[model samples]
Every structure is written in structure tokens, then in C-alpha cells.
Target: MSRFIAFFALVGLIGFALPRSAASQDWQLTDANTFAPANYLILTIPQDEPQALAALADTLAADFGVSLAAEWSLNALEVHCFVFDARNVSDVDGLITAMETDARIRTVQRLRSFSLTEMFHSDPLLPLQWALQSMRVLPIHASSLGEGVRVGIVDSAIDNHHPDLADQMVDLFDFVAADPVPLAEAHGTAVAGIIGAAATNEGIVGVAPSADMVGLRACWQQDGAPGVCNSFSLARAINFAILNDIDVLNLSIGGPEDPLLTELINVALEAGIVVVAASGEGQELVYPASLDGVIAAGQVAGRSVPAPMVDVLTTAPGSAHRYVSGSSIATAHVSGVVALMLSQDPTLTSAAISERLNGSISDVETLPMLNACTAILGPSEACAL
Candidate 1:
């Protein structure tokens, strides 16, 4: 019976989030100048000959007038080459035909733009949506959403026009360009909205609706391909957050562990700032989530076997109210809950807060999930899980 009910509930949630027509929106061409600056041209070459393929790649880069960024050997039969600034293909269709005709080339794919905002709007467990509903039923009410907290989001840039988050954005910094204005990336804006959207009538409110937000653009915006800023950019962002005396630093991005980043995380910890990071997809742990003093979070559905470990919901971008599931989204949940805890006691140190959160988690025997509020507030001695 539980299985039967769970199946239907999953279907119902999907239906609620996405209507038939809404799913068929046409893919639009990416504007290189708007948000992304360069398009990536990915070419797969025959892998049997490394030296020959490298020579071919150099020839192709010179012939196509594009910069060759990285090349990797994928087994003995394939080599992948990444080309940057490839927006101006003389003839895209012709180029594909030529590549298909080339004996050395195996496949060619163009990187396209993906709407991060639209992706979030389709989430089923929107964080802010859950928080508002929970506020009505829970005994604790946040005196004010983010009454005295400052959150720094190191991602893309926030949309200054987002109705719920616009006013709360206090500053912008572009680590890539060393400028005050952020490079336009919808990913950052969506993240910002999740962290601190206002309780305005236009859309769903953030968990910390009144919190001040600092937008730090640490990720690069490529024209046709997804761009990533390196570990240095991330390390710098963490330092900036610490220097500014930010109460919390939210980092939703992740990659392979770097020693430099590990060192910087330690510095942030010593400075008494709460650092929250998304645990990677599935159970795979990622930094800074895996780092000590950082809250690592996972996602859960409303009907999942166990209550979510930091399974706080949030509003999706744009007008549609969808719920998203990700460690990044979970980071927002922890950040909002931390804001509530700080509101109750401003003197709580970062280490103290981390200890309280880890100790307060409600143990679910069914699954590895922890209740966000219970975790933040600590377990009640009289209550049984």
C-alpha cells in the first residue's frame, strides 16, 4: 500500500510542476554578448594516434580561427578537444558536414545555453514555499527574516530585477574581471533568489526574506558552452566573504578537491563564518561540503521515506513555482535555517552553530535524512524520533 501510494504521489507532483504545453517551449539561440561570452566547440577525434591527433587539432584551431583550450584522450579510439570563442562559424551546417566527412574526426557537438531559472521553476520542493508554510505551523517564528544576517553567494550574478530578491541585493563583485558589476549569468541570480528573496507579493519569498545579499560572480560566462571559474576564483571569493565579515558564505558550486581551496576553507573557519556547500549528486561528497566546519546537505522529497536532511524547499525562478532538488539547493536550506538560529542568538560562533546543527538532527531509522529545523534547534530530550 505504501508503494502504491508513493507511486501515485510522485506522478501527482510531476503533474503539478509541469503542464503538457509548458514542457514544449522551443530552444532559443544563445546570445553570446548577453550573458555568455564564448561558445564551446567540442570535437571528438580518432584516438588511435595521439601525436597525429594533436597535430590535427593544432591545424584545426589555426584553420577555424578558434582557440584550443583543452584536449583529452578518451580511450584509444577517441580524443575530445574543446575550442573557445567559436560563435562565428562560417557555416555551422557546413562545418558539421565537413567534420562528418573528415576521417580524423569522430563527432562534433556545439554547447548551447540552458536556462537555470527555468530549470529551478520546475523543482517540486521549492525551499521558500516550504518555509512559509512551516512558519505558520511551527511554534518558532523568525523575529524577522534575516534581521541581522549577511549572506554572500559565490556563484553567478543576481538578477537586479527579480521581484523577491532585487531590493535585498546590497553589492556585486566580479572576481573574474576585477570589477563591481557581475558578469551576467542566470545561475547566480537563481541562487541568490533561493538564499534571500523578499516576502513580496510578486513571488514566493526566500527563507531569509529580509537578509542582505552580496553577489559575487566567480563563475565565468562562456558564449555557447558552460564556463567555470577555477579554484583560485573560489578561494578569493571565500577570502572576500571573510574579510567583509559576512555571517554566512554559500557556495553551491563544486569540482575536484584542491589543496589551496582546502587551506582557504580552514581560514574561513578560523574567522568564524559559517560556510555551506552542496553535497554532490547522489551520496558522493564534494568540497567544501566535505570540509570540516562546512554544512554538507542532501535533498529529499516531501514524501520520501525519511524527513529530508536539510530538506528545506525554495521558490524557482520566474513566475512558475517549482521545487528543485540538489545539494546546492540544500545549502540554501541550511543557510536560511542558520539565519533563523542566528536571529535567536547572534552570539553563536560558527563552530558552535555547526555543533548544534550536527547534534540537533532528528535521526530517521528508515533513511539517512535529518529534519532541518530539528537539526538547527537540537533534539528535544523528551521527544522520540
Candidate 2:
């Protein structure tokens, strides 16, 4: 029940204090304008002396008008500098040259800022028909549709006005605004489409075509961002879903573990609702997905590769088809599959549903490439454990 503003304020107050191990390297800003709109510059410095690195960082920060954002100790040395102005780009180059000349700096690279769109469009899903036929998975034909289940989509608010989803949207709740629409990132719309978009020929079909949708805008809008949600608002949205008795909850956003959110998820599970969460893109597992009782889904590229420990493919708005991979998209697929299972039997408890899912997996033997359909449909008796 903690409020959003208070939580964010608390995180802000912590300021930028790099962990002890990361404080070893001195990262100097060379040129700021090299990156437009300000991007992170990564520097790898020698790690022979820790105190020297910290002192160097302090001196560089004073010499150049840049701030030390973060640092990590890895194979060599890692430092991130936040550039405030474009004019510093030239300064950054000069700084790099000076460091390289001094023999301390090993390498410097600009951290590329990637868009969700670029990530998704780079790889697309195999045609649904091909996936079903080749994988020998259950066909998501009109016959296996999720007719009576309700899925609560917690993310940016949906357009509801979009042509494909306009009529399928059932209810709306905006946890971010004084009103019911979200203005952050179109994240909700994209997630919602992945879960239950109607079967319109203009775009790709959702995993659960017949399921009803409940759009909850729990993320606060960032300035100038059109469709993104924040963590605090997300916690509120989860509570709202439980109170409203949503059958399935699809959470695509995650962050560090929040004790408050964890408690809420336990309560919802006890109430018999199935929660599906994304495991995040990197090696680290994000919360809600990592928590007990939540199905942590990882992304897969196509039918060919093993389920990606980090990516998934689904529908995006317009006529575009993108890989849309993330723990978020993977969570939606799990939610859709859960809806399909629920449609098979509405009375199944959350625990029972989870058991069936874990017990029936086809690729559980393979560590990470486990497919859900194989999990739910169970392999032949010869493959049974």
C-alpha cells in the first residue's frame, strides 16, 4: 500500500554511490557531443590500484564538467559517464586520447541506446501455422480459443481506440493519472496485443484470441513519453487486479525486488489467480518473475532456437510484425497459454495449473529451452519421466 511518489523519492535520495568494488577505475569524459541526446560512455581502465582509480575519477570529474554515473569491475575496468551537454563531445575525444596516451585506458566504447522497436523488428516469429505444424504443438485455431477467461494486463494504458483491439477491450483503470488513460510508452498496447488481440487479418493474432482483457494503467507517465509505466504505479495495479478478481495477470514490467509487491503477489496467488511475469533481458532475473507463485517466462527467438533465456516474438501495433522479445512478451505467452488451460477447466486452482504446466513441459530436461506447449500437453509415454 506504499504510494508511488514516496517510493521514487526514496530511491532518488540514495544518490549515485557506486559499490566499493566498482570504485577502482577513474573514468574521464573525453567528448560529450559524440553521443546525441546524451548517452553513456563506457571506459575500461586498468585495475591495478583501487585508490588511484577513485582519486582519478574525482580529479577527472572536476577537470571535465561530467559526472560519474556508475562503475563495474569485470574483466578489466568499467565506468559510465553521464554527459549533460552536447558541447562536451569534443572534450570526451580529447580525454580519451589523453587516457590512451597515458597507457591506463585500455578501451572506450559508446554504449548504444537501443529502442524496443529495433530489438523486436530485427527478428520476427515464424508464421504461427509453421510454428504449430513444425513444433507439433497444439494449434491455436479458433477451436482452442480462450472463451471465458479474463486477463489483466498491467502496463501502459491501451489505445482501446486502435482498430484491432477497439472492440475487445473490456475495462480500463489508470493508476498513473488523475484520469484513466496512460501517456507513458505504448507498452501496454503492445503487451495486450500479445496476450489477447482479436484475430483480425490486418495484423498477427494473439495467443488467446477469445479471452477478455482488463487494461490497468499502473505506470506513471514520464515527461514526453507516450506509453510507459513505472514500478510504484505497477504495484498499485497488481492490488487492483486482485481486488477485482481477474483470472490471470500479465505483468511485463519488473525491477529490483520490492517487499511490498512481493506480499501483494502472494496474496493474489492465495486467492487462486495465476500471475505471469517476465524474467528480463539480461542474465539477471527481475522481480515478480523471480518470486514464488509467479510463472517466470523467458523469450525465445523462433521455433528453431531454444527458448531464448532472453527474447520472445509477438504482435506490435500497425501492420508490423516484430520479435518483441523480453520477459514481458514471454510472460504474455504464458498468460495466453494459462488462459487456454483455464478454458479447458475454469475450476483449476493456481497451484494445480502451475503443477500441470511444470509437470507437462516437453523440454524441461533441457535446462532453458523448455517450451510451454510441451510442458502443458505432456510428451508421449516413452518420453515420460
Candidate 3:
């Protein structure tokens, strides 16, 4: 594994005292920017030949009139990644095609973004998260707080110091920058807040409050900045999750399909980790979720899509709470419930988890709404012999 990959592990950490980052989603700054990169592309070569990888990067840089920004090698998987300088909108597609024609290149992908909201919460808030009722998670919490289940979150920065997440976070690693210091936590804070915020009776509770969490940051952050994650960073995070024996992987971001990421998702599934993904708008699903062996979750109150999408309240970066509305939040709900099920039966495989979820689906119309009590309280389930 690369030194970058090696940085991720469960360890005792210091205090988080960074300034808070406020989120504002204006028209131009949609959440989709998190997964997609307009000017960047991720090139994966099958082998880890340093010279060959350097030559490829130089060739792409020279041909595209760009610079070689950085490179990383996944030694375990023998996958090499090269990140080139940004390009104009007119040049991105052509540059990607030019790189794809190389026989040495196994896959070339234009990094795209996925949508996930980060709203500041204030004023009169619901005493309890309204979405929990629809998800059917409240009842199951009586028996399972998702102990012993490790839920892995691959997204933007999370506030490791936030009271809601400080103690619950089992591990933290970054794929974008090797910063020895902790980076700003926004989207990641919100995502983790939903999945496993501590139930301290301070603010809105998380879905699997007691479940252990390992957060792998593939996206960077800035105040009012959209979520940012490229294929290379995301794959690196996924590889880390797989190597660390993560029980359930939560991918709350998705965009255009990339073969390299697809292969990694397949690898995680084959390793018996339950993978959860978010659904984008329209029938054409997003990557990973669109791929086989991933559970696609959409936020809907009923079978039919409502005019204004349902709003969900979850945890935020600071000690405060927030409301996020989208499929990403919905995906977190499913992941939390899945963790609850895993808490009851830690040996459940991806197939067994899916089977239980599928069998417990009370209504096909409400796609993302899950029957948590049934999924977790049912007979212990595992991969068939």
C-alpha cells in the first residue's frame, strides 16, 4: 500500500479546535461538485512501474499542455494514479480520449462530483429527527446500538472534534492531502453526523449512534465550497476501508461511471463488506450505486416522487445540528439501519444483508424507506454455505 493508504487506521487522536466552516448552497454551488472534477482526470495503469507511470504522466502533460500535479501508487492493488493540471471545458473530453488510447493505461476517467447538502441548523428544530420514523430505526435501537459494527464513511472532511462525533469516530485518514494537521470538516461532519453521531441527548441523535466509525476523507473543504472528490482519492479511500476490515462502507457521493472505481467497488463487495450508495436524479443511476452489488437509496416519503423533496434533520460539524435534503442523506439512513442489523448479526455478508433488506421491504414504492426493526430483529442471517 502507498504511504497515503498506510496513513489510515484506528488510533487515539488529539483535540479538534479548528474554526467552523459555514455552508451556503447557492445556485452555482450544487453539492454534485463533491465527486466531479471539471479539469482533472484519473488514469489507472495495471502495473506499478515507476518509470512507465512517469512516462505516461509526462506524455499526458505534454500532449494536453498540462502539468503533472501529483502521482500515487496502490502497491497492493498494483494500480498507479497520475493527477494532471486542470484543463478548460473544451479540452477535457479530448484529453480523456487521448489518454484512453494508450495500451498501457487500463482506465482513464474524468473525475465528476455528486450532490450532498450541508445546511446550517438553527431556530425551532424538531424535538426528534422526523426522518427516523419513516426509516423504522427507532424501534430497533432498543436492542442494537450497532456495537461491534464498523461503518466506514468516504466523503469530505468530518469534524473529528465535534461533540457529536469526537468519541464515536474510530479512525480518520485523508486521501487528498497528507496534512499532519486536521483539515476543515463540513460535508463529512454532516454525513457522519447522520450515520453515527453520539446519542448524548444534546442534539438530534444519529442512526447507529453506538456503531464504530472509520472516516476516509477523499474530498477537501473550504467555507461555502462545494464537495470535491476525484476518482483517485475515492478509490484510495475505498482500498483503505477494505484493508481495515470495514464491516459496512457508506459512499454518500456518486457521479459518472468510471471503470477503475467500479472494479474497486466490486472488490469491496467480494470481501463481504456491505456497500451502500446514493441515487441521483432520473432513472439513470449514479456510479457505484448504478453498478452491480450496491444498494441504491433514494429519499422519498411515498412511492411517487413528491413535488418538494422530503427534508431530513441530521448532525452538523460544530456542536450544532443541521437539515440536509437529498439522496445522500437518505443513503446515510439506510447505512445506519444496515449497521443496526450488522450489530445484531456481525457475520452477515453483503448478500445476506441485501436479502434481509429485500425480504423486509414492506412497500416497493418508498424505495429508500427501510424496515429497520424487521431487518435487525429477524433471525440471525449470514452468507449461505
**lDDT winner among the candidates?**
3
If both were scored by TM-score, which would come out higher, candidate 2 or candidate 3? 3
- Report the poorest 10 consecutive residues by lDDT, candidate 3: 11-20
Assess every candidate by TM-score: 0.56, 0.56, 0.61
Sorted by lDDT (best first), the order is: 3, 2, 1
How close to the true structure is residue 53 of candidate 3, measured as C-alpha lDDT?
52
Q: Candidate 1, overall lDDT?
A: 0.59
Off by over 4 Å in 3: 1-126, 299-309, 363-368, 378-385
- Clash pairs of candidate 3? 32-114, 32-115, 34-227, 34-228, 35-112, 35-113, 36-112, 36-113, 37-111, 303-365
Winner on TM-score between 1 and 3 is 3
Q: Report lDDT (CA) for all predictions.
A: 0.59, 0.59, 0.68
lDDT of 1 by residue, 1-385 (tens): 1111111111010111112323332212233334232256567654434445557777887776765654444333434443434656677666666667777666776644331111122223333465433322122233346678888888866666656666878987777775465245655665676667765445655667677789877877566244476887887887798899788888877788889988888888888788888776665567667776677765433211122324344433343344455666666666766776777788888777766665554445444444444544444321224
TM-score of 3: 0.61
Task: Write the residue-wise lDDT of candidate 2 on 1-385 in tens digits.
Answer: 2111111112121134343555544433344224542244555655535666667666655655555655544432234323223244556566655545655456755544322111111112334423222222333332456789989988876767664566667888888777543332456777777677666444555667778899888764355364455567877898999999799998877777888888988998998899888777766567767787777766422211123323344444443444545566566667877887788678988778777655544444454343444445455421233
For 194-231, candidate 3 gives per-residue lDDT tens digits of 89877654556678889999989998777768687899
RMSD (CA, Å), each prediction: 25.3, 23.5, 25.9
